[model samples]
Target: MPADQQRTDLLPADALQGKQLGLSVSESPDLDRLGLLDTHFRMTLGELARTVIIAGGSLFYGGHLQPGGITNFLIEELQRYGRRDRPLKVCLAWTVHRAMTQDQIAEQKDILGLFGEIHFLSPVGDRLDGPVNEATIDDPPAEERSRALTGLRTFMTANTDARIVIGGKRAGFQGSMPGIFEEVLFSLERKQPLYLAGGFGGAALDVIRKMRPEYAEWFPPAHDMPVPDDRFLTALERIEEIVSAVQWDGFENGLSEDENRLLSASYRPSEIAALVGKGMGRLLV
Candidate 1:
């Protein structure tokens, strides 16, 4: 027989506590175009952190029950901070448009439950403005689009000093190499710290070298991936060439201070637990 499964309705109560504190535009950082883009990605990063806290680290987060960028980063950061075994508390806010369904929510809950807590977002039926229908990834109307991104931004910006911190990695100026370039531009303008993944392509690195030499430092020393072939070797060589051309500080290691500071601040466990469910461990309330 397949293993028996049971359901538990009682979730930890401390799952949602921290409130967002928005910062005045004047008090915000001096963001260039790239900085603006980083801010957006950082917002997502914040969301990810929140998920981890709710799920309690022992499990996954975001209701999808998978380890998202923020959760993985938190796990890594916590390990870096020397508390690898501690359990974490977290809260989450997930928005859903009418176009999406309850079944979808259930599925996501199952996933997120694998890691932490999740609070789904819903505009008052007919009470809030804008189209309530869910829009596809390709063509979301302006109002619908705003509906999706604004609440999180407002919550995050207004709650600048939120207990949970937020940050992300950048590939030079692009959000993530080999992805959407426009979105990458937006991520940069937001001031999200560039992060280097081991697998970033050499050709993509070359573009960064030509366009924004200053950010080339985020790339770490590259190693071969599971796949071994002439093409991969050639790509690795090209990436090395790009890294060699840039004169950025910590090019072979990680982000610089100003960048790292933001990352550090946005990843506090207490704060993240507020947005994401706290992970497995003792809950202190």
Candidate 2:
């Protein structure tokens, strides 16, 4: 992002009008290695949410809705600004919704109703088949639960206009692939305005490593990290396949290649919001 473009005054207030942005983020295992703290990630998330709402856009989050979880965090952010009822959209997969007792679900629904809507998605069918109801399954097969989350991500992608990815875990995910890797692949598949804020150094940075290998030097070395299993390696290979077809180097989000390079390596929220605001204002026009 250029100095002038980053000026807060230059940001487009209505860049996201009528557009919903998908947020793909998680607790990264390597935040420390990148000289970041958990608060840094949390602050960035709040800042981005604030930026989006202020810019006349809503948000979508497909995750749990615990008291202090990301879902509520966004809800809290939405409350900070005025809008139509339920400015945020929270998507819940059958596997996740069922994990909580019906009473808990009811309780959450009551709270979310005030700030955003909750979408209860039935389990996906076929190979990763799930029942077609909101009923909770007790101790579902590990694979079934994981597949359900994958289905939720797909549903979220179908609904949102663009995406911003940041801190993500590499493994131990309920989904077949690491959630971050799979979600990024889906956004790439759709050619949605994808932004990879790799500066915080997590799985998002890892994904960028594949897209622009020459920028490998921008990330922290991975020797001390746990080795990824064959499954993770295979998922990563899928990223290359997706990006190759999409020509991701072209900066499809109304930004120049140079601006995107800066986006991938920036940790500041102001710059992220400005880059996204500028790109969306033009790309979405």
Candidate 3:
């Protein structure tokens, strides 16, 4: 069907209507060298978010809050094109907000609260008391912090109808597993519709590399990509090993083999958004 006709057919019964779509995005520090820049990353995400918003769905955000950061960038885009009914919902784990000053915490809440509801999630164990601040509270052990992040992602994945994963750092992350990796794994286990736009590269591309090496032809050579530490590599391999037990050839995210192939290769925002929209459209939801 033609694009205009597809939109017309969607009408009031749009598959995207009222859906809580999760977004997992960030940059690989070396993303610019891979042919996609920070500007490119935001634009692609903005376009994807816009598409979902226009169809009456909302985007779930779980990112760090800072001046002119990626989270604020998405807010600005939503301000330009989003409706009041489709406000952006942001989730913050304890570790994320704890790193901020009290003033920054208030500032972030004021800003994001204007867009949509803000979820302040607690750590998996040992809840802290007092105002959220970096100085007042001691940082949890690396292991506990890792579990907190996983708890947050698990909550986000469980709540959202589907998930879209983009760029992310694969190493030196605070979690036992990389953030995006945990999200993807949980999303797969829950059988949520997963859209991995690996063309932009990062952990998402690394996932494609591990699960579908043939798709690497669509990405730049990984020779210059940062080599992860043994711990990170070990974590990644173990996660992959666990996910592989499902005994599937690929992620069963409501897309066919050919569609997923393109989803892993295409860097264009319109193409990526279209494919995601296509996959979500196929869902029984």
lDDT of each: 0.31, 0.78, 0.73
Per-residue lDDT of 177 in model 3: 70
In terms of lDDT, the poorest run of 10 residues in model 2 is 125-134
Q: Write the per-residue lDDT of candidate 1 for residues 94-186, one digit (tens) a residue.
A: 233334455554564454343333333333112243223454234445455444443433333222222221222122211112212222222
Expressed as tens digits, the lDDT of each residue in 216-264 for candidate 2 is 4677476777778777899889889888887763258887778788878
Q: How well does model 1 score by local distance difference test?
A: 0.31
- Among these predictions, the greatest TM-score belongs to 2
lDDT of 3 at 57: 82
Across 96-139, the per-residue lDDT of candidate 3 in tens digits comes to 76766788777776776556656667785233444454484457
RMSD of each: 16.0, 3.2, 3.5
Of models 2 and 3, which has the larger lDDT?
2
lDDT of 2 at 143: 79
lDDT, residue 149, candidate 1 = 40
In candidate 2, clashing pairs total: 1
Task: In model 1, state the lDDT of residue 179.
Answer: 19
